[model samples]
Structures are given as C-alpha cells and as structure tokens.
Target: MSKKILVWFRNDLRLHDNEMLVEAIAKSDEILPVYCFDPRQFELTNYHSIKTGAKRAQFLVESVAALRQSLQSYGGDILILNGKPEELLPALVSEHEIAEVYHHREVASEETAISTQIEDLLWKQKVNLKHFIGHTLYNKEDLPFPIKDIPDVFTQFKKKTERDAIVKPCFLTPDAISFVTVQDWGILPELSELVVNEDIEGLSQDSEFKGGEEEALNHLHDFLHTGEGMALANASLKKNEIVSKLSPWLALGCLSPREVYWKMKEAEANYGLKPYFNQIVLGLLWRDYYRFMFKKYRNTFFKPEGFKQELALVPLADSELLHSWKTGNTGHLLVDAMMQELNATGYINTAARQLVATYLVYELKVNWVMGAAYFEEKLIDYCPASNWGNWATVAGVGNDQRLTSSFDFQKQLKIVDPKGAYAQAARA
Candidate 1:
C-alpha cells in the first residue's frame, strides 16, 4: 500500500524552511496540503471586537492565496477550506486514506487544545499525527533549560540562551511535492465572507506590507543587503525610524525566524555587527523569550495576573474606556494618532505600540486583556506569546520585575516622534 500524508498548514505558511512539510515529503509517497480557515477565529471577542479584524483577515487571505499559488507551481495544491480543523481533518484523512498527518506544533493554550482534539480524532482512525517545532528561532530541545525552567525575566533567559543555546539550521525546501488527487479545492474566502463589517472606511487595502513567501524573502534580501540595507543602517541610529518592518511576515510564518537570523548574521559579517544590527537580533531573541515563557506558563500568560503573581481584586475590562482607546478618540494626540495608524494599516512600530498600550493601561486604567484582544484583532503581526505576554507585562501582571511601570506619553512623543511627523501622518 502506498503511504500518504496530510500536511496541515497552520501558522507556518511558507514552503521554505518548513520542517513538517519537508519531513512529510520524505516519509510519504503522496502529500495532501490543507489549510482551514477556522470560524472561531473570525468570531467577536469578549470586548465586542472581531477576533480577527479586517486588516488581519485581508492579510491572511493574501497569504493563503500566495501559498496556494506556490504549492500549485510545485505540482501540489492546498485544499483551502472554511471550517474547523477537527471537523475537516478527519474527513480528509478517511477520504484520502492518509497514513499520517504532519504539522508544526503550536505552543499557546487554545492552539494546543485544538491540536490535542485533532490528535484524538486522528488516533481513533489509527492515523499518526506528527508535529515539528517550526515557529521559534531556536529549537526547544536546543535550549539550555527545560520549558519549566525558563526564567521569569527575559534578561536572564536571553543571557543564558545567548551564551549556551544553538539555533538549528532550517530545513531545506522540497524541490517538488508528490501531489494527491482531490475533487474539491475549496474556494478561498474573502474579507467580506469572513468578516461582517467588511466595508470599514479608512481600513485601507493598499497597506505598505503584502503577505507571502515571495514578498518576505524579497524584503529580507533588501533589508539586509541592498539599498534598503543602507536606508535601514542609516535609520537604525535614529529612534524615530524603525530598523525593519518584518514583523507582519514573521507573525504569519511567511518568513521563518531562522532564515531571518542567518540573514542578519550574514549582514553582520559584511557590515561588522553594528549596534543596530544587534538590536534586530535582540528583537528576535525577545520573540524567542516570549514563546519560551508561553510554553512554561501556558494559559496563565493570558490572565490579568500572570504566573507567580498575586491575583488582584481590581476590576479589569472596562468596556467604555477600551472602546475609546480602540477608536482613537482617547483625546491624547499621540495615543489617538498611534491608535489610528494601527486601525488603518494593521502595522505599527514597537515604540508606538508601547506608547498606546501604556496609555490605555496606565492612563485610562483600562484592562490590559482588552488592549491585547484589540491588538489580536487589529495587528497584522500579532503572535499569541508576544501580544499577550507584552500586555501582561505592561499591565503589571506578567514578567516585569519592576513594582510599577508606565510610559510617559509626552516624553515618548518628544523622544520618538518629535515635531509630530508620525502623529501628523497618522492623523492625515
């Protein structure tokens, strides 16, 4: 009997450095590529905001569309479906007589729960569910400490990991994937189909960023080596100019962290490890730190009071305040401008994110989870670990060692966006 495998595309969307896809191609005689648009993700959040807002939904659509085209070019086609994975996978397994299922392991609580459910369903059918770590820069096993032993503070984790850990080389992209026949290649849903309020004015479609493996690789090349490199190198010295806008592609898994790391190393070699270059590497380290922290603390990372923290009696989740912040009508110029940028483009620099989040949590006294959820909906670059963990920290509920923390909005504006270039552009 011929062996067949179902390669489930989750957050790890690209063909390059996709360990699970590479492994499946090696082990199976035929491959069934599948991507499911989970309805649950499109539903409204507790804060009365769509869990996946227009900007993100549109980006996801573009990403998946790009994935489908790439797969087609390789003699394989992705079965893009609009349904729950647990419901869809079993049917695909039985119909195709799939010997096994292969996918990247997700670390967040909800994602892990869904994976567990699918594993259980697949087990009853006697099909093996294989998982690989594809999201992080360093493999979990390569880390010096176990997940439980990952430090509470990022500095400690970064120091230890940077000193000892190794980032494994990325898996090679398969030259060709053996295609399996399927009658229905489900239609890829548009923003109108997935989101109810699709006609959101000012929610511009022509974002500076476009999603896909092609765009990602191109951006990586230009940012690291070309004229774009000179621009970034020049901008790195200034606080106002962002060094790279690679987070959206990173969040969608269109670009792997390892790929980015290796490219940065090459740039460092050519340009002699500038502080700005190191800063980019530090950002990637911070990403790894958050994922490891998420792995250790699990669902507690999302709670108002995070792990090892005392539960507070303070009422979090003030809906009215949250709405004001989300809509960019907070009456604070910088905060409102930042919020507007986020709402319109689904892209904001790290500094702007911190400013608005601090304003919402500290100044307005709104619930941090509300702010996080709003970002989850709005941010094109939203990763569960980075988004929630950062929110918890800012809310005085997560990994911060400080007793209290808040960003001064005026001070921040003066330092980062002085003369209001960013604010003015955002408002316009």
Candidate 2:
C-alpha cells in the first residue's frame, strides 16, 4: 500500500522549487496537503490592531485557494483548517493515519516554537516530521561562517557570503501524484469572515495583489521573460519600480527564493548580467542574514536592547507623532505618503520602509519596539527577523556600527522622486 503523508503548508505557499513538497512526493505515493489559518495570527495584539490585518488576510485566502486548485490538478487536494496546529495536527494524523508530515523550516521565535512542538508531537505519534528551509536562496547550513558566529553588521555579513556562499539548486516535483482519500472538510473562510473591521480603505483598493501559485509563477515569467527586468532592477537600486515586487510573495512563501535566483541566473547568462542583479541578490542575502541573526539572538531582536544591553540612547515614544505618522498626516509628504501607501495596501517598498522608520526613530523619537509591532500588524511582507532586525537597525539598536542615523525627507524626495511620481500616485 502507498504511504499516506500530510504535507503541511506554512509560509512556503508555492509548488515550484518547493523542497518540502518535492520530498513529500518522493516519499509517499499519496499526499494530503494541509493549511491551517492558525487562529493566533488573526487575533488582535497589544498594538490594538489584528496581528494579520484584512489586506494580508485577503491575500492569504486568495493564495491558499490558488494553491488548492493547483494541487487538485496533481490528484491532491488542500485541506483547510482554522485553529492552533498543536491541537489540529494530532487530530489530522489520527484521522488520516498519516505516516509522515513534511514542511519548510521557520526561523522566527513563535514559528520556531511551533516547529519544535510539532516535531515532538509527531514523534510521539510515530509519524516522521520532515523540515526543509524554503524561504532563503542560501540555507543556514550552507553558509561559510557558523550561524552563531555570523557578523553583527550587514556589510560584514554580505561581504562574507557574497564571496563564500553558493546558492543550491532548487527541487522540482512532477505534475501528478496518485489520488488519495482526503477526509472531506468544508469551505475555507472567505476574506469577509476572517477579517473584522473591514470598513478601512485598505480593503477597498482597486489595485489587486491577489495570491496563489499560478499568479506568482506568472509574475516570474512576466518580470524576467518580459522587458520589465531592466526597469525593475533600476527601480530596486534607486528604491523605485525597476525591482521585482515579489517580496510579499516571497515573505508569505507564495514564491521560493531558489526559483527566483535560478531564473535570474538563466536570464543573466542569456542577456548579460545587469548591475541590478547583484544588488537585488544582495537584498536576498540581507533576508538570509537577518534570519540567521534572529536564530542567534532570539526575542532580543524585538526589544530596543537587541542582542546587547545599553543600546545607545533609547528614544522616547511620542504618541501624537506616531499617530500622525500612522495616519499619513505627517507634514512631510514623502514619509506621510509612504505610510498612506502601506495602510492602504499592507505592502511598501524596502526603501520607503527605511525612510519611514528613520523618520520615526530619529526625527519623531518614537519607541522602536512600538514601530516594529505596528509593522508586524500591518505589513503583508512582515518576516520577524527582517522586520525586527530592520527596525532595530534604523533605530540604532540592531547590528549596525553607527550610533544613529536619520533620513532627510526633503533630500530623499529630490534624489529618488524629483518629479514626485510616487508621491502623486500616493495622492491618486
């Protein structure tokens, strides 16, 4: 008899170049795909907003639906459940007699805790739990320096890995697996049910950032195979649109970095490499480096005293200033506009993020952790390590040598958007 396996889908949402999915297929003839909405993610935090807001929830629902459709074409169907994994997975394993569970590894504190607990639970049930790193182009075990010994500065980390680390090739899965009996469950929660206080402007945007494996794959084809590659690369370097707007998908695991990296290599070999390729890949390195830092430093990443005591002067929180910044009402049009864009779409460009954080910490003297928590609630691309690590860096708390740095809004607007195309779009 073919072995029954549960392939638990977390953030790694896509089917392409997905190591966990590939391993599950190689091991079992019949695979039951599972995705849990994970109730804790939907609940409100001390920040007084949802941990995962409506915009992100809408994207997730769309992505999960797309993943299910794709899996169905392969003789497997995605089982959707809403609850804690600790309670749900045990019931699922018993119900399906699942012999093994396969998933990608997560590095955040909460996610790591869940992974460890799940590993122990599956062990008790005698079902093998398998994990593979899917979010990074370069895995931790493949890095030159030991993860614990990873440098405390981005430049140092980047310098070491730029020369030393090699991106491993991604795994691919065949089109189909044999049919398996999945205990029929009903409809996954729609965007309306999953989100409360849906009346905000963020929910009504005409700009669509829908989820799913096919959409992400199509985006890849459009970005690389089309003429937009040079444009995006240029935009990314200048903190504009020339870059691949794939980070949200990457963050949510709708697309794997390995798939993107290989595609870049193929394009470079064909058309000659662009300067943008190296810079964008450096962005990916920052992602991996922060994840390693999080594992090494733990919850300290979220605090103002990140990975060290006596962080250079702790900035006081100015509630009035923060509220203005959050609502996009700050007098500075660039900073306010960026905040407005984020509030409306739950996503923002990397450059805009740094500028806004710089204004908050150095200009307004807002508490760093408060800003990080607000981002956690709002950003669709919110990865704990990247988000927290980045916030700490801008606030002079994380792995930077500088005592502090502040952004000059007027100077950036002139340099990055002299004609104010982005600002004009924000108004529109």
Candidate 3:
C-alpha cells in the first residue's frame, strides 16, 4: 500500500517556501491538496458586519483559484470544497485512504480550535496530522528569547532579534507533485455563493491589486529593482509610493515572509541598508513580533482590554457611529478618505490604517473590537495577529507602554498629504 498524504491549505497558500507541501512530497508516495471554504468566515460578526465581506471574499476566491491552477501545472489538483475542515477531512481520509494530513500551524484562537477539532477527528481514524510553522519571518525556536520572554515592546524585540536571531532559508518549491486522484474536486465558490455583496464588482474593478503567488513574486521584484525599493526604506516618503504594498499577499500566505526577507537582504547588500532596505526589514520584524505576541497571549489579544486590565471602560459598540466610520461619512476628511479607500480597494497604507483606527476608537468613541472586526472583513491582507494586535495597541490595551495613543488626523494629513493627494484620489 502506498503512503497517501493530504496537504491542507489554510492561510499559507503559496507554493514557494511552503514547508508543509515539501514535507508531504518527501514523506508520501501520493499527495492530495485540499482547501476548505469554511462557512463561518462569511457569517455576520457581533458588530453586524459580515465576517468576510465581498472585497476579501473576492480576493480569497482569486487566491484559491490561482492555487488550484498552480497545483494543476504541477500535475496535481487541489480539492477545493465549501465546508468546515473537521467535517470534511474525515470523509476525505476514509474515501482516499489517506495515511496522514499535513498543514501549517495557526496560533490564533479560532484557528487553533478548528485544528484541534480536526486533529481529534483524524486521531479517531488512526491517521496522523503534522503541522509546520510557515507564517513568521523567524522560526520560534530560532528566536533569541523564549516566546513568553519576548519583549513586550517592539523596539526591544526588534533589536534583540535583529542582533541575535537567525532567519532560516525558505523551503524549495516542488518541481512536480505526484497526485492521488480526487473525483469531487469542487468548483471555486462565486462571490454570491459566499454571500458577498453585489457592489464588490464595481469597487474591485478599478483596484490594481490581484491575488496570486505569481502576482506576489512580481510585486516583490518590482519593488526591489524599480525604485519602489528605495521608497519602502524612507519613513518620510508618502504612503502611496514608499510602502512595498506586499501585505495582502503576505497576509494570505500567498507570499512567504522568509522570501521577502531574503530578497530584501539581497537588495540591501547591493544598495546598502541605510534607510530603504532597513525599513523593509523593520516592517517584517514588526509582523513577526505580532505573531509571537499572538502565540504568547492567545485569545486575550482579541479582547478590548488585550492582555491587560488597565482600561477602566472600553467603549461600547455604537451602530450609528460604526456605520459612519465604515462608510467614510464621518466628516473628517482624512479619516473619511482612508475609509473610502479601504472599502473600495480592500487596502490602505500603514499610516492610513493607523489614522483611521485612531479616529474610530478615539473621536467616534466606538468599541475598538468593532473597528477591528470591520477590518477583518474589509482588508485583502487581514492577518489575525497583526490586525487585532495593532487595534488593541491603538485602543490603549496592548503592548504600547504609553497609557493612551491617538493620531491627529489633521496633523498627519498636513505631513503625509499636504496637498491632500491621497484624500482627493480616494474620493475620485
């Protein structure tokens, strides 16, 4: 009997630097790749927003479609299904005689819960489930300090890790995959099937961002070689031009952070790491910090108080206020413009994100979780740790040492968008 393995695709969607996929290929005679579109992700949240709104749903759809195509090119096909993994995997194992399941480990509470449920189910069938870490720039084991001892401050964590920790080289993409035949490789779900709003088409059509590994690599190359690299390194540079805009692909695991890190290192060697390349590495470091924080804090990271009890009164959710913020009708030019851009393109630069989040939590006085939840729905690159952790920090409950943090929208507008180019473009 041949050893048949199932590669479960989750947040880590790309083939390049995919450890789980490589492991499956090495250990099994036949591999079956699978992706599940869990219905729960598309449901409404407590904040009355669809958990996965149309913009993100469309991106996800595009990503999965690309994954399937990539697999097919390797002479393998991904069995894309619309169901919970726990309910679906057991049947797949039984039908295909799958001997093992391999996947990337997810530390977030909800993802961990689902993984645990699937593990228990697979265990009952006497099949093994293996998990590998592929999300962060640095492996947890390679970190200079233990996860529990990871510095609560970003600068402290950044310094130690940059000085002491080592980033392992990325895994190789397989040349060809030997696939086990799957009869019911279901079709990718349409936006309407995912319960996405009809208005998404109009919003996404004008947006240049597309979801796929190919696109991710292309963006990386363009950013590094084509002067976009220099823009990424300069903090004083405008958001529209300076940032790499790689977060969406990174968030979806369509691109590995390790690949990004290595590429940036190459650029640094040639260009010198003074401002441009150093800044890019700093951004990757910040992402790793949030992931480690999630591992250390777990579900507490999502709470309004966020691993601390210092906040006396977390704001209650206000439907009208949230609606105004979400719709970009809050009457603050900069905040409204950022929100409009986010709603339409499912993306915004880090500065814009911080400004809008600060406005929602401070000026509008709405609960931070509501704003976070909305971001979860809207962002093309929404990673649980980075999104919620940043929200908590801005909400005065996370790792920031300061008791309160708020951005001055007008002041930021003057500095970053003096002539209001961003605001004007967003409105247009």
Find the candidate with the highest lDDT and give its number: 3
TM-score of 1: 0.94
Model with the higher lDDT, candidate 1 or 3: 3
- Residues 187-261, candidate 3, lDDT per residue (tens digit)? 998888886444644654556778889989999988887765665445446434467889999988999999998
lDDT of 1: 0.83
Candidate 3 local lDDT, residue 113: 97
Clashing pairs in 3: 233-276
In order of appearance, the predictions have TM-scores of 0.94, 0.91, 0.93
Give per-residue lDDT, candidate 1, residue 399: 70
Candidate 2, 1-428: lDDT as tens digits: 56888888999888888878777788887888889988788776765456777877878888888888887787667889988887899888988788888888888878989988988998999887888888887888878888789887778888888789888887775666654686684468976667765554436646457787777878877777765675554453342446677777888888888888888888777655566467668778888888888878788877677755865655544477888988889887778888988988888888888888877876787777777888887887788889998888776667664534445545545656788887787666
For every model shown, the clashing-pair count is: 0, 8, 1
lDDT scores in order: 0.83, 0.78, 0.85
Rank all candidate structures by their TM-score, best first, as comma-separated numbers: 1, 3, 2
lDDT of 1 at 374: 86
- Candidate 1 regions with alpha-carbon error over 4 angstroms: 198-203, 232-236, 308-318, 403-415, 418-428
**Per-residue error at 309 for model 3, in Å?**
1.8
